[model samples]
Target: MHEMLGNQYFLIRNYFEAEKEFEVGLLSDPDNFKIKKKLIVCYIQTGHVDSALTLFHNIVSTDPKIITDTNPEEDNCPCPEIIYELESILNNSEVELKTLSLAMLWLYCDLEESIWYFEQYYQFNKSTHIIKSILASLNKEINK
Candidate 1:
């Protein structure tokens, strides 16, 4: 039911509503990859990059093989389309390097690459409190 409504909202480009429904669905079934994927998209559309990145990390961390495998029975595995969209976002010029690091982490890129991006962003934008806060959060999360 929530999935269907979320799909409908997504089709209409009403990403906020879709996000809400998907989040609600996830509350009941935290392991539902399909809903998580949809919620990721919603986060992207609504500029909730941090949330999207965190969820993406959680999803991949839960099943690293999902990044490459495509077994039909594995409904939790992300589809190629979602991967492509995420990659596209990572490549977009408007996306900050910190955000790119999160996406890179999601794609299972070298941890060093993510750290490098974050460090570069921090070095260049030290005045940005959000970046500082994000760096602190990332550091804590990565170290854990």
Candidate 2:
């Protein structure tokens, strides 16, 4: 009910009130991806790119497979829009989106991002050999 009200407010361009309602919904349902997605959308709609990115990272990190087989309904799946918007912001170019699309050919589509994360991990602990090995395998797969 609260989510629906928030979504309604969002559709009517009342972002501030929508955010309040969504926040309240989140208070009750911390694990509700649906409400989280709505909140993120409200942020984006309000030009809160940083907030949206934070939410995007949270969602991506926690749920690597944002689009699973169980949720076939469009209303339940905000992943497509989330991915599209993030790709636009992250890449901001036709060429870059093309590159990202190619990179997502195999694996979980966020594998490219994982590679970036692994590089950061390597920087912190150069002696950890597993990260490098997995990176090499992923690189080989990406290149092929």
Cα RMSDs, all models? 6.6, 8.3
- Clashing residue pairs in candidate 2 are none
Clashes of each: 0, 0
Report every candidate's CA lDDT.
0.60, 0.55
TM-score to true structure, per model: 0.52, 0.46
Q: Per-residue alpha-carbon lDDT of model 2 for 1-144, expressed as tens digits? A: 787898788666577889889889888888887666567656755656456545544654565354122242444333344456555565455443333222222123346664665565466567855546655755654465
lDDT of 1 at 27: 87
**Could you tell me how far off, in angstroms, the CA of residue 135 lies in candidate 2 after the best superposition?**
14
lDDT of 1 at 77: 27
Candidate 1 differs from the real structure by a C-alpha RMSD in angstroms, to one decimal, of: 6.6
